[model samples]
Target: MSYRRKHTAQTFITNALALLFIFLFIYAGLSKLIGMSVFKDQLSQVPLTTQAAPFLAWAIPTVEVLVVVLLLWPSLRRWGFFSFLGLMLVFTGYLIYTLYFSPYTPCSCGGVISGLSWRSHILFNLFFIGLAVLAILLVPSKSLEKQQ
Candidate 1:
């Protein structure tokens, strides 16, 4: 393939991934905010987060919304991908810890995602993590675009 075609393909993939992340964050953030009481209760049930449940209940959705804002801005899209990857890694790591190490596992996820089993949630996060990595790789730097 030609340079132009390859660049176009990469751009398309990156944009698609951004859109997906935006949707995921928006949905999750809104879901948690809307059901604040339930979400907080769920978080409180998690032994590790029981003490910080209240603060995290608010902070998590706020960060998700912030990430959505980053993803929407063209200039900040690369940072958005990095942010998404970092969040996914943290979430997946927590899930792994809860699944294998912790004696108690509680689902604090919002929306339909709350229904997913722990193993399924890990897989879901892994899939998004992989996409986040691909988006980071495919997103062209502003300098590169300027030179082109």
Candidate 2:
């Protein structure tokens, strides 16, 4: 394909990925907000995160919403992709920790994700992480474009 066609395709792919993240965050964040009690309670059961659970309980959804807002603007899409990737990485790390180290870890994640087995959840996170990475790669950098 020509550079223009390829660029357009990549842009479409990246935008689609961002839209997916937007939907995921809105759905998950709203679910967490709706079930605040259950989410906070489950977080309290975790061993290492017990103390921080209260803060994280609110912070997670807040950040998710913030990132979604950033993703909506073309100018801020790069930041959104980075922020989304970081969140997914942290989530994946926790899942890995829970899967191997924590003997009786409870799922505090809101919505349908709470139903996923630890192993399946890890896979799920990996998939989203992949999408974030793809979005990051496909987003054209203005400076680099000019140099080329």
Candidate 3:
């Protein structure tokens, strides 16, 4: 295809990925915040996070919302993709640890995501992680856009 068509396609894919992450983060964050008690209890049950449950119970949702804000702004969208990728990697790593190393795996994931099995959750995170990587690659820097 032509340069313009390719650019348009890339822009569309990037925007779609951003919207998906925005929705995921906002919904999951709100769900956790709304069910703070349950979330904290779940976190506390995890051997690794028991001591930090109270702080992390609040921090996780706050960071999720912050990421949504970053993703919403054009200039900061790249950072948002990076942040999304980082968070996904961390979460997936923790999932792997819980699945293999930990005898008891307590999931503190909020909303519909909490319903997924440990293995399924890892796959879900991997899918989003792939999308985040794609978005980062497809999103043109401001300088590049200006040149184009």
Candidate 4:
């Protein structure tokens, strides 16, 4: 309950969440790059995405990596936080679209979450989305933290 201890805890949580997002984004982006053929094939199977497969194939991983870079710098870390938050929301939306509207939901080509069932995958996305939201809420703005 000491002020110092509380401050340490807050700092730890902030850094931990930043690291978490960094790891996830890097892993995902690498997975796509490493398994390009498989990822492209998976994207092709999704309804209404066949034509955009080429564009998305390059774009998703690129943005993920960009977010990782953003997270590494203190000055731009807030942008990283917001980027991941938006990405997670978009991901969840795609997952829902596949589950409810598409005829079939294809599995991810790589990453730990690839093994999860569709329902579990949804939960997984939601879990990370919640984490992102929590991190954003808990971490002080860079200027504010510096001034503290």
Candidate 5:
């Protein structure tokens, strides 16, 4: 393929991936924001989460919404990608922590996906993070250098 064709294909893929991430994040975030009881119910299934459940119940969804907003903008897409990756890393850490230190199995996340083992949760977030990273890398930088 010519350079232009390759660039177009990459851009299409990146935009599609971003849209998918944005949709899922926004939906999940709205679900959390709309129903605290549902979130609390899900939290009860996880052990350590019970302690910090309230804060996370409110915070996670809010952050996800913000990340989606940022990712949708051209100027802010890089920041969004970085923020998303960071959040996913934190999520991975939480899953790992729950798996090893907490006594209870992780609860269903947001009542959307059910019965995800801690390992599965980590891998899922890792996969999304990887996709976000790839999308960020594919985005064209604004600056250009003139040949000497």
Candidate 6:
């Protein structure tokens, strides 16, 4: 109810969300990097992705780490949000594609995160996409007058 309380509440929410994003990205990236055998196994589970599995295992983690770094910086954070949004959308699309096109379900996503069914996968992507959108929307825009 108090002005100070409201500001504190808003700051808490923003920082919490940022921390969540940072943790998830870094953890997942490390999982992929350190668990290559598991990552490969998960990728091989998808019929069409078998050939692409190796490349993705290496690439995804690198991109994720970069995104995490970008998101941590105040100035470059929008690019991070945008990149994450795109990545999540692509992942959601992959899940949909695999659900309908692939003969077998890919059990290789990488441990707990990878084992999710198509529906859960879509929901997962949507959750992050929502977060990225919220982050972008909440980011403050500075004016030239403020700079001077």
Comparing 2 and 5 by lDDT, which wins?
A: 2
Worst 10 residues of 5 by lDDT: 139-148
Off by over 4 Å in 4: 1-4
Q: Is candidate 1 or candidate 4 better by lDDT?
A: 1
| C-alpha RMSD for every candidate | 1.3, 1.4, 1.2, 1.7, 2.9, 3.2
Per-residue lDDT of candidate 3, residues 47-121 (tens digit)? 777899999999999999999999999789999999989988988998898788876788778878989999999
Task: Evaluate candidate 5 by giving its C-alpha RMSD to the native, one decimal.
Answer: 2.9
Tell me which of candidates 2 and 4 scores higher on TM-score: 2
- Model 1, residue 134: distance off in Å is 0.3
User: What is the TM-score of candidate 4?
Assistant: 0.90
Clashes of 6: 2
Candidate 1 ranges with C-alpha deviation above 4 Å: none
Per-candidate TM vs. native? 0.93, 0.93, 0.94, 0.90, 0.80, 0.79
Ranking by lDDT: 3, 1, 2, 4, 5, 6
lDDT agreement of model 6 with the native: 0.76
Candidate 5 lDDT (Cα, whole model)? 0.76
Q: List the residue pairs that clash in candidate 3.
A: none
lDDT of 5 by residue, 1-148 (tens): 9977887897798688778788878877776777777777667667777787778787788899899998899688778778877887887787787778877764546545445666777788888888878987877666621221
Pitting candidate 4 against candidate 6, the one with the higher TM-score is: 4
The model with the greater lDDT, 2 or 4, is 2
Over 4 Å off, model 5:
41-51, 144-148
lDDT of 6 at 18: 70
Which 10 successive residues of model 1 have the least lDDT summed?
A: 102-111
